[model samples]
Target chain A: MESAIPLHLETPRTRHKRVPDDYQPPYPSFVARYKPSVNRVVMAYFGLQYRGTAAAAATDALAEIAARFAAEGGPSHWDRAQYVDQAGYENVVSVAYWDDIARFDKWFASAREAWTGAQPEGIGTFIEVLRPTVARHETLFSSLGRPEGVAAISGGMSGEVQEHAYWGGMRDRIPLSQTGPMSPGGNPELIRDGARLRVKAHDNLCLIRSGQDWSDTETSERKLYLDDVEPVLREGMDFLRDDGLGIGCYANRYMRVLAAGGDASEKSYGQSWWKSLAALERWAESHPSHVRIFGAAMKYLSTLGPSAKLRLYHEVTVAAADEQFFEYLNCHAKTGMLAAVETVAA
Target chain B: MESAIPLHLETPRTRHKRVPDDYQPPYPSFVARYKPSVNRVVMAYFGLQYRGTAAAAATDALAEIAARFAAEGGPSHWDRAQYVDQAGYENVVSVAYWDDIARFDKWFASAREAWTGAQPEGIGTFIEVLRPTVARHETLFSSLGRPEGVAAISGGMSGEVQEHAYWGGMRDRIPLSQTGPMSPGGNPELIRDGARLRVKAHDNLCLIRSGQDWSDTETSERKLYLDDVEPVLREGMDFLRDDGLGIGCYANRYMRVLAAGGDASEKSYGQSWWKSLAALERWAESHPSHVRIFGAAMKYLSTLGPSAKLRLYHEVTVAAADEQFFEYLNCHAKTGMLAAVETVAA
Candidate 1:
């Protein structure tokens, strides 16, 4: 609170240039180093228009890319629920990722090019790049291994304020243990089963351990320093998990924080990977208890103060590939005399 | 699926300027005519550092705006949830809608200024914009109030594809007929007691009238086209609602269906928006269901995919204004400035 601690960096401007590995404390404990892992992430959002019969071809190509990525245990990918604008035109958010920029480039070039090449026509990709910065990550509830546990396996998404009230009720309605258990060790298991509960349970097992704010009467409407907020949040997360109620994702005193001026780090925002939409649907359809609690939570949100809000954005994995083929794809695809010669050579 | 319809327009390159409202659809539909009636929604996401104190101020301001809009029977507003980012930071998204663009602009200007002015010393705002084009849009579910019966009113979220699976599964688990009926002229007398059940019921009871996909069969996967896919989606959605499930969201599929390209849209990549960190936190505390769903979704995503392949970005919204505001406040401000300070006749 006191003049807001000067964050480690004014803003996450250059932080995302080289994707970080893991969360680091960025702060020092009582005479010790507490560096949080800083993962570098780069995102390029594209708006494209293609020729006839290309949309399906492109999407299928993307799906293939995703399937391949899944097989390789790579960054997840998928097609957002398809949507259209007023002109009867359709579009999507092509999403892809990479731990290493070089690898990403490889995937971008090779796999992406192959997919595009298969298209009946060319695509008009967005001119401007799209990226955002991220900070203070937390995982609230998760489970794995069960039919309903798939939801828990994936990481939580960047939240919108409008939906908070609904989730608030949900936290109260569902007992944590029922959803899943807390991870006693550092490495929580991933969901191999069909359900999201398996993942949810494991996620609950792993406490936020950092970054959080608790809901206490005294702290109501009060500003908290990250130092103050983190410990309290950690304790509360542990308590929730210990009590068998899933840990929650919350930032007390919503609406009062700000990013360091001039900060520009590419952040992550969007849906996660699923074996298929079918896989996701099955988990939801079969899980009645989870659904009940989830419903009650939503109803409660509607009754809360007008402090929440909602926004939806779709991300489609327009192009993607693995490390091996990128070089020959994006980097080597040249137009002109050389391209002509290469085509003839092929 | 016979050579799908050509949905994209080959506009001149110069016209590709992506103005704020540049995404206007050339065609006409409910979204074109009725979108204005329904509030224009925005979801703002912020990182953890910003969520400390600055975010709260911004969220408070947003809540005030949402209330004002709701008072006018305008569109709804709220912040959905906080998500864990690869960059090792926590991010929150806020959702809000306004009746008229003018009102929204007024609120946005006021909020923006207030946010900047009240920004914590070190913390700044990181924001991004994600507007769905035809190629990438997801409107999986939609529900309306039955005549007078209200089946249910729940709070839910739809994450970007990169984060995790869909968050709507929460809705699937709720009991059917929890509230009264649908809307626009159904049986309003069913749950007249104003009890939770009565309130839960939809007014015009058009439960899941339609969806994007019909069945989850592999066979359906083969015919993935607007023409081929639309019918199944419609049927599936109808079944959900008619079978007691609520409608998701009336999607703008026409554009997506039209743009039959090999890939999806550009908005699929990383994108976010939020005033301050604190504001994001308040939203999280208030909305726990989102936390649970988001957390579960994220964890599930971690194992199913490779963390190394992902990329994230964070951006800040310095001066965001809509068209109505450009005409109202901006123009008026300029006019006022030009007003002849006329030699005060001094």
Candidate 2:
């Protein structure tokens, strides 16, 4: 496999992690667009916990995933676990760029045997996926090698890597662009509308990340990345990509800047929608995918010999309707969490 | 632990498995009875499946269960797996004699923590418990080790173990005994009147027995029983014992005959009840306890080298009320699968 076809971006200060407090984004937040051939992005965060025996299966699954990605005209774009280290969980969060959601869907629907066999029973596997335009989602990163996640996967991303100082300055310049969906009812020019919108009671907000200074060159660590990492990411993406399974979840996206480098991002967050808080809790604790991912993580972490930088943390957030803000700008059709909120749209 | 305290029944011919085709009990249909001390019997069937990784957990849990019984005064009378073996599963179905359901309930309610820790996430643990009197449920076999299931757990039972040939002769001499609850309505008459009685649609019937010639005292077999079997079994029993957690299950009881020797009870059956088929299915496929039991078995099975006489099979039965038959003799009140059924004293 060669980065020759199109490494697209120039590498800068060796793509490093930025402690959250010290981090800033230099790029203007806008509705991102892909090249003519690129139409959608597949993002995922596959995590691991360090305690149990099931975790090993996760790493093994990951390796199988990476190999698959590397084979035959694979994903147009892909990234590894470059996200910051949060306290609770170690995860492999990445993105794959594709021109058509259908092609990606086709592979997912047909490629069962190609990935890890029946998800390990003891492990936990939690996943999320999204196909949002630049206007629907926004991201920020500092000093990354070329582009990563959605930005990297999309062919037309301005491949320039910037410094932390540059990010600090850029933050003040770019007010966030619209990230919600284009309401079918058109724009609302309400000042003090008589009708009061009811705020919903449920939301799913997750901040997940791995340990500090944890990435090492040890044989196992390398194996974690090269073998187990990619396939697992693919599995997660495939999981969320399937429309049939995304029951309560509206949108699933993983942003590199949001997931990476900074200590703030070390405990990165996942923003998704659910019909109810109870529904979200159920999925979190017992969903097959979630349990499997958790199990695999535990198994893998257990093998790492203690003292290996490792702590995975999560602060789940459930919110009300009024508490969330989502919108889209000069972008295309449905996008973001709000697009799936039927009540608002109706 | 000493059998001196009215060890009750006599052991006959080292209770062993009888292949389905070869099994034939000659006693004319009759309900069994225990001495005055016997109030109810707790019967159970624990089984295994040979192919998967979780099978090891099943055997291990069984061993743990057997030890628990042996260490504590043991069941008043219990039998090793001796029921006829059908194709498909290996099971240990045995009974424990309980003079007072209260004592049994006390042990169950308080003895939870002493069992296995949080149920293993990978193994599959399924169990069934019945507290029935001699009138409600009857057992007829060629020979069985004394002290099986609830029969052994209780205070006293007839100290006679007879061969089927002897049973065949005994049948012509002994007439049918009472096999119904003492009616509060004070009528032996109501039952026999030729009035069409409606049969209920909800019922659960189980016939679990282990496989034939499947157990081998090989290294793998010993390791499996010692390491994986006990823990898995303990976990499952613990899971159901927890008042806060045993959601849909009514009761759980496991005895050696239902889980012991004779082909590892490879074709054991699990007889239990649920509010509905859907509820039972949900627990079987997704509950943490069930999954963990399955996983442990798989892991344990995978590790065993070949030449291990291992076979685990099961056919879980959920029946409609009319399809199941149960009764309570002059023995006690509120026992058997049909506990809610009205008691009628004959």
Candidate 3:
């Protein structure tokens, strides 16, 4: 939650990895861009694999939480997913994007009421956080109004820049500001009064991934889905969403791999963002949702015998929210990294 | 939860089904009994099918709850099980038996703190309840002390008349008496001041059955456990527990079927008790858990290409608490049906 040490310090938090020239877009589909007026971006996934009556409770809980978000205008972009896969385990997840870390923090603390309620008892759920910068991360979204993740709050912009791969090579993408001398180079005296974007020393970003697609029926892939996968992924998703909110998660989405690229076709992916590593780990290790879910899994594996198809995976990454450069090209105003292009580049 | 109707009125409740002559002890294992002096008994199972981090969370939650129960001095007997199957799915469950419905009722409410806390975003959770009487119900507990369900509170008794069944021959395990003429052979004067156990007129009992094992995977018994069934099962259980509670369900449990007599080896059952059929039906029909669980099952059936192994079944029974018979043999001092037999009969 607190800054992961300042960017000026020499640590993993400040380490900047230049984007690889061989890096192709992570998605096979066309991707849209969003720009917003914030130094940080947060993405998350809320998903579960379920059956029985509790599935409905999960959905109801999600609907209730969604309603709460809609009322509070919690995230800039919030999207729903029916059935999502976590490794081999089947699940449902929602992807949400937040432009303001402060707003996200505030919402996370006081919004307990949105998640406080009764839900079915056996669904498995967790939150994942992925902190992507313009350089290391790429996304593709449909133009359909169902804008997921960060696309909902972005506006259009275009420009180009040579330096700072972290800025992602948009035409006029620019950085938000913080006090003190900016990184890479000292403040541009010429741009001090100009519209140049700014940067902070210790902006923190996080990446989280967690979900299960198969359970006891995990020994064989075909039988896994045939026996364990829920035919209606949405039912499970709704159950998860309703229950997901009860535990604190900044934002999460259940994603189907329409284009697996090199990955398995049946595999589903989830993306989530959290304020810090501590917050994310605490929920995973100590919370009831995770504890009960994994507990059942261990018991299932022990009772039902070998299950090779069911699997769970996760990755965590943290970085400075704003890097040293920005370039907004054919992007929107609400998108992170280019959200305030005009205000900064001018 | 009020009673369905007054006990004085002639209804199905007042009707007694004499123990059948063909009846036999319900289990292959030897069973002991406890003679608690309470008319109404409450039993439940907390189970989930989960994997990865989520399973741990479920266990943690349960552990926390068990600790709370231990702290609160809950139930006469509370036990734990792992890899228990309910129907076809797999999970771990904690079976609890309460001798006093009044104490159970008190614990259900006002004990919110025990369940309140931060959990992961998506882990389906649910509660189920079932009501059964001596005639229709039977159990066997291992000498290992892992007492479950009704067996947790029952005691042994051997003295019997040729007319009574091992199912306690309580002259009226008869539904607990209301403030009226009692039941079929109403004669309050015979034992006006006897220290007999009593039950509330409207005290409701629920029977919930869920969780799957090899049934959904039975087409290829080898493939059953190979496929992931825990996710959906957990999802399903949570949906039921959450939605069930929202409705009139008093409690529920996810059970592992250790033995099913003549049935296939892999089968688990759930038990949930409800205040009234109407209350249960309302929640089942309109609540999110039932709708979504069934919907998910339908979708799962539709998607997996073949769902022959998957099956869902449940039974419902409503009855008065005290039965029409009671026989006190050599049993412990805490069994239901005759909690204070010595005190009352003396």
Q: What TM-score would chain B of candidate 1 score versus the native chain B?
A: 0.28
- Fnat per model, in the order given? 0.06, 0.00, 0.00
Chain A of model 1, TM-score against the native? 0.30
Error of model 1, residue A34, in angstroms: 14
**Candidate 2 local lDDT, residue B175:** 19
What local lDDT score does residue B18 receive in model 1, on the 0 to 100 scale?
10
lDDT of each: 0.25, 0.35, 0.38
User: After superposing candidate 2, which stretches have Cα over 4 Å from the reference?
Assistant: A1-219, A244-246, A258-271, A330-334, A342-346, B1-79, B82-94, B97-264, B268-346
When sorted by lDDT, best at the front, the candidate numbers are: 3, 2, 1
* Complex DockQ, candidate 2: 0.00
Per-residue CA lDDT of model 1 for B141-218, tens digit only, reads 221211100001113322221211223211211212112111122211212221111111112212111112212223
The CAPRI category of model 3 is: incorrect
- Scored against the native two-chain complex, candidate 3 gets a DockQ of 0.01
What TM-score should be assigned to candidate 3?
0.24
Over B1-346, each residue of candidate 2 has an lDDT whose tens digit, in order, gives 1111122332221211111122222221221336746645544322222224545665565566666556553445544543211222333333343455665556543222222222333332222344544323333322233322333343333323232222111211111111111111210111222211111323333222211222444675766755776567556645543431234553333333334343444322233444432243334434556556645654555455334444332212233233333322121222222233344333
